[model samples]
Target: MFRLQFDLDRIIGTLEREGWVVIPNALSATITANLRTACLDMWRQGLFHEAATGRASGQACRAEIRADSVLWLDQVAALPAVQAYNAAMDDIMQAVNRGLYLGLVELESHFAVYPEGAFYKKHLDRFRDDDARTLTTVFYLNEGWPQQAGGQIRLYLDADCREFVDVGPEAGTLVLFLADRFWHEVLPARQQRLSVTGWYRRRRSSMPW
Candidate 1:
């Protein structure tokens, strides 16, 4: 088996320098495809409910809350797709050892879809209710995408603490970034865009000042 390896120092160094890092193809094609199918299936089965928010551009999506996914636990936990995603996270966490510096980290997975013309306005992923959110992970689930698709993910780096970087929404692309450092948003989608996103939460015990 080809053991996928990453330069831990480089990963940590980049996180400090750029505030974010991209691990290309962290999941194999086979694994990615399966994950895509499973994610789409979850959406199709009506497992998710539309979220009421100020941002909406004709895209339809159901936010799968991490704390309330009990209705279809078997559908999500038994699938190899979720396993693969978790595994990828394991690999990343193992390499960077972000845990060593941050205490008691947690992740909440949310599946989202934006159909044609759907877009998300500029915003931050961290929850304002609390400062527990630290990092954000966005794993693209689309395949055979084109540049003009317009479903691009723009992630700004300290762009006035509002917006700065634009990450590609291409299939199999994974974006890892600081959740509260800068503002980010998704542009209008020429076609449908699907992705799995979650936050790596940090507690006071780990990120104390």
Candidate 2:
């Protein structure tokens, strides 16, 4: 009897104005804990990279080798709490695609781990001149993160570099925003700052790739 939950209009409006919105407790603590364990195991096996060579430059662990690569996604999808995450996204995309003819939704995801003094430079998540990549989502993984830890995302909502918003990397929080609308960066983390960031796209034409 668990119907889809979340305010679609509010989220869209917030994204338009603030450039981002964070949803708290998007996943249960139990699942987050299990996912942390799974990621740690993978980390021990050397399955991730220490850097991503692009708009981001930071002393952080990156796991961008695969979309939905985290073992926990598959493991917890069956759980109602976890399934809500997917369902909410599906609803968000459906609403976005309704006004556009033949637009398609595509998604890719990865994880980033910011250790002491780790950070990323400001950049847009999509390729310019292409409006197909509609949005981006980042899920954070770190319990009881401190404000002094300095792991916050600084989001830009203006072209002249005047407007901005800062979001913290609190555990079980998910940040979603339009991909092209903002330029953002992660502040240096004093401790381990972990997150899974990704994008959702819409095809520009027929036979969309």
TM agreement with the true structure for every prediction:
0.78, 0.72
The CA lDDT of each predicted structure is 0.66, 0.64
Residue 108, model 1: lDDT of 66
What's the distance in Å from true for residue 95, model 2? 4.8
Quote the lDDT for 14 in model 1.
Answer: 82
The per-prediction CA RMSD against the true structure, in angstroms, equals 5.9, 5.9
Model 1 per-residue lDDT tens digits across residues 86-199: 766656656555533644255667667776777777677765455777778888878877888877777776657454556667677778788877677787778777788777
Question: Residue by residue across 128-196, what tens digits does model 2's lDDT show?
Answer: 445666678887878899999997988887887688888889878778877877888887778877776
Clashing residue pairs in candidate 1 are 103-206, 154-166, 155-165, 155-166, 156-164, 156-165, 157-165
**C-alpha lDDT (0 to 100) for residue 145 of candidate 1:** 79
Alpha-carbon shift of residue 120 in model 2 (angstroms): 0.4
Segments of candidate 2 deviating more than 4 angstroms: 1-5, 16-19, 54-88, 95-104, 129-131, 204-209
